[model samples]
Target: MSVDVPRRIVIFRHAKADWSQESDHERPLAERGRRDAPAAGRWLASAGIAPELTLCSSAVRTRETWKLAVHELPQRPRTVYEDRMYEASLGELIALVNETAEDVNELLLVGHNPGMHALADALAGDAEGDALARMNRAGFPTAAIAVLTFQGTWKSVEHGVGRLTAYWSPQE
Candidate 1:
């Protein structure tokens, strides 16, 4: 299939969670995280990057992050929740992106890290700034977003083929 180049994908790691809680999966966003969400959303909007579809982990923090971020975007359909996204690996996340409908040009995936960071590093080709290195060093912070561009279908995206377009963090 001759897919178009420059397909955009945005990956966001869920905001900070309330560690006081017991289970990691059930932890909600911390107050700072709650505050950071809208800021991150605004940053995305300011950059004119909006997702046509949002795929988020069903975890509390992930859902909350999505709700906050989508608020900055134009009206659209509800997000797709994937249970597998809760603690999915980079490979799993890539597979999920590949499964997205071909009609959708832009997509956003919000989930947790190690996986998110790994995916970013995997898809990124010659990351220019300190962003990718910072991401690798500290892990994706709460309310951080990485934008990538692929030259073919998501299924066809491979290492070094996806370009790192941008990276946004709440702290900066």
Candidate 2:
């Protein structure tokens, strides 16, 4: 894609996780999560928000969520399960996003919060409709996604450089 082309980023929080697992990384999704994840995917598909690349946390919950959600998409994108994203901070997440290849115009991040939530808020210098307010009011709950649009190369992605174009959640 050209440097001037608009790029989209969907920051997604993994679905609700089962707390019974002793290891956090190995925790699977709860029943509600399974239900919500597919809904999130259908919403993405219906909204025509397909990413060219997907960066997912290496946690079991995230993996499971992606497995369910991706099946609803018309096409599958390149997906990477990154270990560092399990508990990444906002800065760390931004750095990871900056490393995205310039050719990929749309990127998806399936991870945790408050990093996902913080990234959405930080990148969005402005918002459309009541997306910002809804996101804030919802507190970025599980299976939630924030859609941001920005211009320039991935390396230039930074705070206040994007517009929050949309926000969605299972409850909504």
Best by lDDT: 2
Task: State, as a TM-score between 0 and 1, how close model 1 is to the true structure.
Answer: 0.91
Candidate 2 lDDT, 44-139, residue by residue in tens: 999898899999999999999999999999999999999989999999999999999988999999999899999999999999999999999999
Tell me the TM-score of each prediction against the true structure: 0.91, 0.98
Total clashes for model 1:
0
- What tens-digit string does per-residue lDDT give for candidate 1 at 47-80? 7886778899988889988788778775654589
Question: When superposed on Cα atoms, how far off is each prediction in RMSD?
Answer: 1.7, 0.9
Q: Lowest-lDDT window of 10 residues in candidate 2?
A: 16-25
Error of 2 at 133 (Å): 0.6
